[model samples]
Target: MKNRFRLNLFRFVLLLFVCVSCSQEYDKALEDALNLAGENRPELEKVLRHYHGDTLKLEAAKFLIRNMPGHYSFADTTEVKPYYDEVDSVLTTMKGCNVWTIRDSLVKIDNKYADLSPEWVEDIQIIKADFLIQNIDSAFVQWKKGAWARHLDFEQFCEYLLPYKAEELQPLDAWRTYLREFHPDHLDELRYCDQLKNSSLQSAITLNDNLWYYMRPEITEASQVRPIYRLSTRLRMPFGICADFTNMAISVFRSQGIPVALDFTPQWAFRSLGHTWNVVLVNNGKNVPFSGATSNPGQPHKPDERMAKVFRITYAVNPDLKRLSEIEAFVPSAFRYPFFKDVTEEYMDCEDVEIEVGDSLDGRYVYLTVFDNTEWKPVDFALIKGSKVVFRKVGMNSVYLPVCYEAGGQMKAIGHPFLHTYDKEVRPFIPDTSRRVTLRLLRKYPVLRHVQGVVMRLDSGEFHASNDARFREYEMLYRVTDCSVTGREVVLPDTLGAFRYWRYYQPKNGSYCNIADIRFYERATGKQCVGKIIGTDGCWEGNPGHTKDKAFDGDLLTFFDAPVSSGAWTGMDFGKPVDIGRFVFTGRGDGNSIDIGDWYELLYWKEGGWHSAGKRKAETVYLLYEDMPRGALYWLRDLSKGKEERIFSYEDGKQVWW
Candidate 1:
């Protein structure tokens, strides 16, 4: 008799859970949900009554109850109250539509139907994608038998109607208007690329191939060219950054009814920068990811870097992500998606990494940081529950440290770096216990601001741009993927010659690599190489104010420029020539159009005239491996009539353009 009584109690509790989970008593839920209707409650009531016996009415009511509170949290409830007619209009049509289709979309729209107040459902984005297309204007082409929907599943189909919004770019409607006006008949052509064999891959490839060359990436001021209005807008100025490319990709894909989302890393684990790209949901049931705007699907230029984390944007509300906003996660309001999916695994190898920290727990968030040359950069973060903080699905083959972002946004490291091996092994590097380890830390200083540059040691003093990597002897040391304002550390080599010369290779992009100093330490003894700036090729080049000599003036603000022609040359005569081991050259940074040589020849004056040291095909701030004799003039001759390049140089122990 006692056992039977216990079982009965358990059954009653279980039944109660089910009822509460489904929004408590149905009548109360229905009544409360209807109350949000205000003046339109009568119309809503009429629609609910029309489908009284059907489950469609209850489902419609549940969606409103689950999401309306969240919508009101941001917007004025009173102001949006009149929108109840729009709500009723959609609900009325649901009676004739497929019930499960609506239910599936609602499940994605709002995860919780029961327990409807902001705990499980703090954020709500009722993606009225279906209603918007089906009921709104008939400008959208028919989905049935159309090229857009023929390859998509039900979920992928919804991504089209769900508008993509990022940053403060132009409204998607304006993008649509431009597409219709300009490329009315090109839709079919934009759906497939001939190179790709897979029909599923065609859509993305087509979008990229059609748009890549058309919207050329020109370097422009960020303030002048944003909220890009249309293809015509880009045509007027034909340039943009990664963000602009992503926006264009979103606009193009969505306009054609393809499923695409913008995914980005807050910060790169290896590089001191961040990037954004597009992921398209193809017919193969897998997302074909690409570096949108700059690269097309399956291209060689696609970003294949190991991203630490990826956050996808969605038009629908994500409940968990929404809660982070309340807890002061510092996530941008635009980033507060209806929902976001972490798809890092799809792009790269990832593992759940846990760092053991012996400290008292606090509500403050702990972060996973990667050593980006000079400082530890926070890439991913999580709340500290106890002494352990776990970073989920981090990419392998990089060094990471556990840290916390303190008040005022200062990042404080909690532990030393541990290498995450490619084979999925976590190995910590303790400084004391090592075999022939790094003897001393070298050059941990900032040299440039938001720049990308290369470091090299002189393989030859010959200044030639050659396709043969060995033609000009500047052995690459390291690549500063993202040079920062605070600077960076130049990782030194294990072994160093007694008299070594190094040069910083700044790319010909529009940013100056303003290096304050260059320091190299003898690996064994820890002795520093005090490099002095000698002179530049500016004295030999054309025009005043823009002569090659400005390159050696020790000022980033000044640069050299010459006419676009072959045989254009610049050189430096190291006074009373010393055995030259290296030449340092900086690209012109004032504008994007300044031509830099792609192919050039390095010549040294030996027998009273310029003699060929070697030929090179590409120009970089290089240290030629071969040591040239003293008293000989060194000059660079452009083989191609492209943009004139800026050149800076240093000899043996002296700086090139101090």
Candidate 2:
């Protein structure tokens, strides 16, 4: 027994010595890699410390170094040595300053090197190192101790750090700066975000805040569109549309080591436009969806309209989709995006489907589409094999149409639309060939994508006993810009409103409509209502100096605002009420076209009770209203939420809403 014990002790000591030697070797390798970062070596060491004693991270770091583009072999010091020297020089000058100033300096260097020999430029690894160094220093101010202290594998690092650069609207490194900007002095509220430590489901609550979601008006001409950047957006902070919110939250959470992705539909299946949002991939391998500019983080963002397909953005290139560029010219621009990863399966409740196409299509690519509000939008595509093509894992509970790209880029339907049931059954929209199924789908939801301003005239300086034209009681006009090529012509109900001069208004960003002209004519006599102009009056705040007079000053440049209340009114009194039958609004040609009225309600006061004379949907540049009770007390009120009534009237006749 004594001899056996001695042998066992010797074996144990040998094993311990071997383990210690291996650990020392690992530590030396880590140190050498840190040194390669040059002036940013200390920050690299700090980051790697999170992975101390973990072989996985050590292996990942080695892999990252080996796989980094333009990494030189040991013998090629001529290429690698100068690169590191340049990086060290740049970072040495950048130490001790805030991220913004350092970034500005780096931009100048990058521009200067743009013309320099490509050989002098550093490897992407060096650029990544510099970014990390600068971001880590800035993160310290926000986190105060451990900002990105969490240990993440190489994949996590790529997901969080790799693709972040200056985007079209956001300046480079703007996200790191945001950490300090969000809660500079009092970040404790954001620091103890233990709630964010949970799965993406719980972490989303941290991202959900009071941010408004508004789509900027679509400009028909592409040149007029402006890209909104993250720095400018952050300067305003948390008060942006969906894109702004997504960028901010993405930058903040990714810096803290959370896996995040931005996904969006090219266009809503039910609406006339598209939307983008953020989603968090939790540690549990499940995706928790959320939007940056919304109040709902506990649940997936479900638009009132149906989504055709959801495309996920990823930093890594997908080999399966790399060949897609050959089939469609737009594929590379869409699928080969550095940030695009098709995770359609995660959001779409889909199933495999085999569609019959009569003969062999061979090399042709088949596409599937669903009818959007305006036209059919192609959602997914598959390559044809035999006589038929198969779409794998597509969304169910939707009507899908098979289409093919013709000689031109135009899509031609190949098969009839069939409803793919949730239970995986595909049935023709009209299963019985003899029985005609008349399915008329009318647009019930009005597009509110571009309702930017309200047009209404306030009550004429009156505190009436009837409370008819009191504060917050007048009909306010809601303005909306039409996205279609042709402007909408709304046939207003006989009693459209009490306002005589109708004016068009747009948001401060200057997104206006193209209105042609305005004409007020009597339907009975077919005569124009333009005659002796009636004087106009409206409710004004503070002083009555800029009253309803500005609305009818024959200057589209000037506008009169009503008190910021729901029931404010504007009125016009013609010398007397003639046969003032109907009014026609004209579109403006000066590009001042801001004719957007989403909803208009004409209320007439009769026998001390407010009566709805007529209400019409206004989505076009020109609006026409017919049928009127001569000399009646009528007023146009805004039904849109949280809008004050402002009116503009034009008439030789009399009696605006009184």
Candidate 3:
């Protein structure tokens, strides 16, 4: 027995040593008896409230609650409840945009501050407890919510997904109800619109062929009649040749006192980025991409200078409709235009274009639209009772634009609000049943191949993020062939600026070469504008100037001398720094043309300060450059100051003579 006792004692000593050795690792534990013994510190109980479900955190919370000490109790001498009530009263005294009211219903079970004469000391304890309770409950409620909505970050970003949902009476769930509840005009459904309407999920497809489908008859009839006030407008960039030429021709014809509705084929080409043109409906018809309604044989209209560039064709939908793309020589398998990220200016929900009033909504989005050319007539809208015009928005949800209506031609729907209403139950659009069926089928069978996984590709396997279906819900013709996920995978050199490439040109032989990873692209601009330098050096063999200095023959890197502008601004100001830093010469020679000889002149206007920062004359500067020819390539170092002002050009005469 004595020997066994001695052995037990030895085992106890061994266990004690092992525990002492392990105490350092245990000290790092969040909160527990072991942690407290190791660190000799109080616990942060509130921190563990966020981790309520986890056993580790629960243990930490217990440690904190036990260790943290409280202040004096107030039950004997003074009433803590009355003070709490008084604080709640103060909260009700104020109200406004920047003001908030505090709730008056917290129960102080312990009269901790009753006898405390100085109210401030008692108030601190009460406030701290209140803060703790509020934070605990708030986290609990948020965590209970489902995974998608519970995520605060996603909730904050959700608005960007359904940007156009504020005023629209119906959201995704209420779309059918809204359509049935409200009156119906017509939804924009060309080839894919029908498919989209019946689809369980909201989505769309870009239909280039739809541009020529239903607008030919009307064009023939309208051409024979004398046209209205001939309207001239610019067809913006990224627009396809088919859309531009066909839509413009039809618009001119349709505006000749004939029936028409306006729609545009949306384009998001790698070459252009975001371009769209005319799509319309004529004579109470549905959405048309092209050729609709017949008035009579119209004279062949001249193409807009912009439309003159599209490849002409001879694919006519009707017997008499002879116009651009009527010959069908060129077939577009997939068209090129701008993408969503390419649009420079973003639009919003509100507009008062007809009244010359300019009020805008906070909701901003990039939309591609085609408007029918017609007189903006004033409608007798008895429904518009309120002084303020109310507008709503929808994407995948159905919305309608009107066609021909009411006696004696006095129509007014020039880009008016398009709305959708569903039955309290279900109402069918009989004429569009085929489209409806297709739309219903679409939701079940999503374009599986188009369910593209957005990835960050590198030398190794990629990490992918699902494309936000809600953000891009509209039926769009997306170019998925060259879709890339390689922006952040591999570290690329500065040569290509912002592109991904694998093969490049050999320095000596000018032959093509390859690397496992590279960054290179042919063009950078949204419009495929190949860069070009305007001015040239006296040597003329190569580029002789930088965008920075006056005396550079493509040798020195400095700064621009001054900001140059078209001299068009408010107050008739010339050389005002509104246009600052690097000068990018733009126009026909703006996209693809770039030259190395083009240089800039730097100047020092400040009289007193003498520093190296001041612009120096006759200093030759050369900067690293990679850009196309005939286009502009400039980066303004400073946008708002004159200290970095400079002129960009190649001719040496300006530096020597000026």
Give TM-scores for every candidate, taking all chains together and pairing residue i with residue i.
0.53, 0.48, 0.17
lDDT of 3 by residue, 375-466 (tens): 11111111121222222221211222221222343332322222122221111111221221110000101111222221111112211111
CA error at residue 253 for candidate 2, angstroms:
2.0
Instruction: Look at candidate 2 and tell me the lDDT of residue 439.
Output: 20
Q: How close is candidate 2 to the true structure, as a TM-score?
A: 0.48
Candidate 1: global Cα-lDDT? 0.46
Q: By descending lDDT, how would the candidates be arranged?
A: 2, 1, 3
Candidate 2 Cα errors over 4 Å, as ranges: 1-55, 58-245, 282-286, 291-296, 299-302, 326-332, 345-354, 369-378, 392-402, 405-445, 449-524, 531-536, 539-658
TM-score of 1: 0.53
Model 3 residue runs over 4 Å out of place are 1-243, 251-284, 291-389, 396-484, 489-658
Please give, for residues 327-379, the per-residue lDDT of candidate 1 as tens digits: 75454333344456677787787999887776664555676765443345666
